[model samples]
Target: MSEQTPALSLPLIQPSQAQKHVTHNEALMRLDALVQAVVLTRDSTSPPADPVAGECHIVPSAAVGTWSGQDHALAYFDGTAWQFLTARPGWRVYVLSDLQTVIWDGTAWAGEATSLQNLSGVGIGTNSDSTNRLAVAAEASLLSHAGAGHQLKINKSVATDTASLLFQTGWSGRAEMGTAGDDAFAIKVSADGAVWNTALSFDPASGFASGEAVQSGPADVTPGRLMRTDYGYGPGNVLGVVSENAGIPTGAVIERGSTANGDYIRFADGTQMCQFNATLAYISAGLCSAAWSYPMIFASGSMPNVQGTLDSDSLALTAPSVTVAGVTGLTVSGLGSTNVTLNVNTLAGASFGSGESVDLRVLAIGRWF
Candidate 1:
């Protein structure tokens, strides 16, 4: 009856109107806790006992407490209770424990940088496959600088082990250089991989190099040697001495000695051509006392005419057949290409007995051409 019960009315407000404000305020409070949220922990499966207001965490698997059944979700503590939001694919989170950035890949979280257990092929700036496992494409590549005074060494297991760089033609080895059967450095070549021939070798101990002549058969192979400047004499001089298999003086084109007396040249067959101070002697007997006889034997092919002198220790005697002299003299007669004859007669026609001896000295000049 229109009567004023009290100064204000309590039942005048509708219940739905009051509930509407409460629901809107609750939604606003949840937004305040979740908008731009930063998670605090991802390691624990259960909610913290005393979580601060508006704090958030990533719910682990089989979560406990208010976070139960909300695995891999974002949990937000709204002062008294925890609220969870399901994680979606491509959601990124920073892992405080690992100090890495991770992203959700539909079902699980994976690091931004990929990690692989093993890989068959890897390529940088190129596509690589099984046959060429590791490939790189760049302008230049360098491998250097271990330390100062350090050497880059290619090592092998033993002396006979091969450690070398091979040059190839269409993926076939053509040449290689390194230690093949010993520590000595050698360069070898191959028409095919089955057979190889050493072209050059270097000795580490003597600092010498040897080269092999390229040939078809074993008999045609001629091994070469190198001599240093300080080998036979002092510095600034080099010498090479080649000898036959039997160590004879054959095939010597040039030979030199420290003194002038020792320098000479010879034919390949060890025949001397020109030499200084050569001597030849002859002794003859059974010469007619006043006649001539040829008695000299030459050791060369041909003999050149030469001036000589002769002497005898016998006394001269005159005969009835003598015309002008009481003494006899010896003269060279019958000179030819191979022999020489001597005459023991008086200057003016004299005769004497037989059985006389003569000594001759001749200066022979010739060649073995």
Candidate 2:
């Protein structure tokens, strides 16, 4: 007690402590007495929250994102991004264009430096589309208006042997075959013209095959004849003939039924050629089937008339039967008497049975009297 005589009692009220005491008193004060504007610093309704009493933070906001004086946005370069506010950090708005959007998402614009060579227009300009050209196989064929109606045209200058190739064309188009004088053969798909389905099929009586190549077939449908449209047996494929060989003569010269004018073979001159006298029969070069040396011998009346070959007898006729060595295709018809003497130079008749017959004629001319 004697050593502390120099020390005197000291008192200091700290400002921080006094402030804490006052705050505590305010919190505990009556609810009615609490100040109303005290919570304005942390409003729950507006964005960019109000800064707290001593907070020194910077928060982004609406007008700061994409707003300008008179426009929604303007490019202002802060030494780097020329006013690309929407693209700033914390914002995740993407863009659409020919690839790179210059204005906004879904805009028909492109970057001048990396995309369009040089283009300017309302929508996606011409040059902008070049970057997105169609791929090789990314096109639809047989479709109209494709590539804006440009067609796949085939022009023939020389004498084309269409027999070796099957062709097709655009919608309502035909592969036309033309000839100088006569076409050896001409058929567009199944009909005369490539575009015609079964409609161009000639009626049974319109015989118009001439001695010239151009004369046969359905005009432009004649082989070597000029066709204009795609030759489709149906609407999708080409003009091709299908043979089952299901029911035909073995030795018979198997061939396509030639159209002198259209589809149906015309009974030239007369539609009524009675199978008068099936003179002789023989096997041709092609084999008929797997069995027998050359398939089974055909019953005369079974096969339809072989048009090109069919001769009539003047009497008990004592001559060698026609040799159908390499006869390609054959057709047999009436036995009307022709004064043209039979000889080697003649293209012989394709025989049916001896008297095997079929009545020929369009009109209802009562049974051969």
Candidate 3:
């Protein structure tokens, strides 16, 4: 026998003719212990005290007793003693403790797939079928990192590709939001899935929002920004207001007063046309009566044109110094864009006595521009 030959080599060696059978029998016993191997346990570091013959186990690191230096090796018992074999990479064995198969890499054992074909159905914590391929029944599930931050990302192949989250009611689409058929982000809703309406959109290049109102801050928005609301004007459904205040700008405006019969339009230059009426107590030669003032200030000190009617209030035919008449003539003067002066004069072209009075009514129309 060659001194360099192992006792378990394929070609058996014997020291002499008498020991040849003994060597062959030993090799046969080693084979019988290892072929079609199934490990009894894979987690323990200590050897079993009463292992059955032909039983095998995987040795763990830092092992004690007879397995002390045989880390990651297979321990096979041949009825009387233990035998250790260094496992090669890719060797597989069924683990009785775990009811699974494990494969040996160069350094350790790892799980191996037991089946390779497709199956009709599979479930995790719940039942699944053809329509819903995967299902999980749990309060919550977490996808987290072992050492660093984690992120969940959805991607599309191109700019025009649709990547969106569709919200549904009973599997009927109700809303969707994302980059739909383009790079711009959009939020769309549908009464029925077939007819969709865009509720909001954002332009990537302009950084502007459209199709809806955009607001900043909780209550007091920043100055110079605009917030929108539905004005309920029937066709023009939206209107904008200054974010911080509601002062009207200096420009043309169509406005209404307490009476809803008509509207008045005023221009920035102080031009106006309005239906106005008033009654004035006039004693001829009395101090001019003040009636109304313009709503806006004029750029220049210009008076508005005036026209109106006059009516008599007293029925007396004559007073101490002046004769009372059936009707009195009314006129307006000192007409400023800021204020108008009303006066009543007798039809006989004379100033009336101090005790007499008349009523004045008018329609004023002019421009401050």
Global Cα lDDT for candidate 1: 0.53
Q: State the lDDT at 236 in candidate 2.
A: 34
The residue pairs that clash in candidate 1, if any, are: none
Ranking by TM-score: 3, 1, 2
At residue 31, candidate 3 shows an lDDT of 73
Q: Write the per-residue lDDT of candidate 2 for residues 1-369, one digit (tens) a residue.
A: 231112211122245455565444333331211212111111112222333221211112333332223122222222222222122122211122122223223222223334555544223222223533422222343546766576545444555422223444443334433332233333334333334321122222444333323323222355554332232133332223322223321111222232221122112112212222222222232211111010111223332232323233321232233233312223323312221111112233433223222211111111111
Expressed as tens digits, the lDDT of each residue in 1-369 for candidate 3 is 563235333336545557677667677776775567788898789999888888888998999999999999889888888888777678888899999889988878999965736867667799998976666668987899867788767799999998898888887899999999888899998998889977788898986676533444234254543453321122232222211113323222333232322223454324455554554554455322446554443335666566666433332423323344523455667677665767654554445566555444555566535
What TM-score would every model get versus the actual structure?
A: 0.37, 0.18, 0.49
Which has the better lDDT: candidate 2, or candidate 3?
3
Q: Estimate, for each residue in 1-369, the C-alpha lDDT of model 1 and write its tens digit.
A: 322113211123234455566555556654564444457778799888888877778887888878888888878777877866666677677766667766778787677867665788888889898876877778976777776755658899989888887777787888999887789998988898668778778897986666563333323323453332222223232222323344333223333232221122333232332222211112222233222111222234565444444333223221233322433444456554344454444453444433333333433333223
Model 1 residue runs over 4 Å out of place are: 1-140, 144-150, 192-194, 204-208, 211-269, 273-369
Work out candidate 3's RMSD over C-alphas.
10.9
Candidate with more favorable, higher TM-score: 1 or 3: 3
In model 3, how large is the Cα lDDT of residue 173?
A: 91
Q: What clash count goes with each model? A: 0, 44, 0
